[model samples]
Every structure is written in structure tokens, then in C-alpha cells.
Target: MRMLAVVALLNLVLVASEAITLEPCALALELTFWRMSGYLGYTLADWLCIVHHVSDFSIQPPLSKTAEKAYGIFGFSNKYWCSDGVQPSRNYCNISCEKFLDDDIQDDVLCARRVLTRNEGAQTWPQWAEKCRGKDLSSYLKDCKL
Candidate 1:
């Protein structure tokens, strides 16, 4: 019974720490994702759009066995949860569900682009999160309004 109480206390402490830790890191890390997502051929909005839809990090840009093996750590379930799950406030959903697990990088990027620009301008990750879906993808990148 004492051990159970200790475990519960530790869990609360760890959970609380994560919230505090993310306050500083979340903006930088997510902003970087927006900046870098373009390198993968995803528009800033494109990446945010797909990240909005994934149910799990394991499924985002779901890599095939060949690609999964190549990405080693990324292949591990929950590894990219920062971008996929851990960051509940941000939806860096760049890769489309259709291509999230796909092995073809180029194809995935194209699919992602389509998803992002499919609507007007380009909705940002924050927009998607606020609206809870893809909608306001503006032409250029937007820093968080906050």
C-alpha cells in the first residue's frame, strides 16, 4: 500500500514537471517543426494540417518496414509524440494520414501539400488546433497570435 502511494505521487510529480517544461520548449520546438516541415516539401500549413488528424505518432507519416527500419528511433511508437501526441496544444500534422505511414518521401510531401493548400490561404497548426481541424491555411507562415 505504501509503494502504491509512492508510485502515484511520483507520477503526479512527473506529469506536473512536463507541463512546466513544455511552456518554454513548446514554442521553439513547434516553430522549428513549422520551419523545417517545408524542407520535407511540406508547406508550413501542410505539416500542421496532417498533424491535426493523426491518432498516434506511430501512425504519422507511417513508414513502411523499409523506411521504418531506416528511421530507427522515429519508428519506435510514441517517439515523436512531442509533435504527434505529447503536445496537445499544437498540431504539427504535416504528413497526411494517407501518406503519414507511406515510404515515398516525395509522394508524402505532395500529399501533405495538397492537404494544406486544399482550403483557402493556409491554416496554421495553432489555427487547426483552435478550430480543431484544417480550415485557415494562409499563404505565408504565421507566428502564434499569443
Candidate 2:
């Protein structure tokens, strides 16, 4: 009986850990994006458009082409912004890339600010240039209570 109880407890712990680590992307709220925009010193509509095209607001967008290179909702590059264990990095953010993959975005916001300062503002992200530059962006914040 004791052994069975121990096994059950172990299973419960495993389930709890998985629940914490694998939080669903659906929990992301539009309000959170707006708040992030405020933190990054960007207009809500423009920031929304950029994030929409970059990671579709995913906290942990799947890594492709090369894992551990681009990460987080804003898709910060490991080569310049953050350090991935597998790559050579400038580590400008002084943060580990894995931190960007989690739901907490304060670090990602700080790093993104550095990226903008070092590069050409929003044009630092090619996706922004290709998808969001000089187009109708008010729609991104339309109907939001702001």
C-alpha cells in the first residue's frame, strides 16, 4: 500500500511539472500585447502588427532552420541579441535564449529595446519592413478599448 501511494505521488508530481512547463498559447491576451508595446515605447498598432507577423504572439514559437537561434514572441536572434548554448553570440541582452521561450516577457522587451536602439528602429526586424512598413496599421488596434 505504501509503495502504491508513493507511485501515485510521483505521477502527480510529473503531471504538475508538465502543466507548468507546457502552458497553452491561448492564454496570451491582446491586452498583454498592448502593455508590451507601452514598455517598448512603440505605438500599439505598429507593435501589434510586428508581433503578429513575427510569431503570431506565441510565447514559444517553434524554432526552425536552426534551433536555438531565433526565439521568443519577437523572434530575437541568438547571434546578436541573446545567447543560445549552441551558438556564437554577441549576447547583447546578456540573457540566455531559453529565458525568451517562457511566458514572462520582461526580459524579451528589454532586449528588443536594445535591438531597436542599435538598429533602424522597427526596421531592425525584416518582417516589419516586409509586412508592416507604411501600410494601413490602424486596423491592428481597431475596436480595442485602449
Q: 7-28 in candidate 2: lDDT tens per residue? A: 9999997854431231222223
TM-score of 2: 0.71
List clashing residue pairs in candidate 2. none
Which runs of model 1 end up more than 4 angstroms from their true locations?
A: 1-35, 55-136, 139-146
What TM-score does candidate 1 get on C-alpha atoms? 0.28
Give the C-alpha lDDT of model 1. 0.37
Error of 1 at 100 (Å): 14
TM-score of each: 0.28, 0.71
Error of 2 at 18 (Å): 9.6
Residues 10-110, candidate 1: write the lDDT tens digits: 99978644311112123324545435345434444544443433321223333444312211112222232113333232223343233334333443334
Which window of ten consecutive residues has the lowest lDDT sum in model 2?
19-28
Report the Cα lDDT for residue 19, model 2.
16
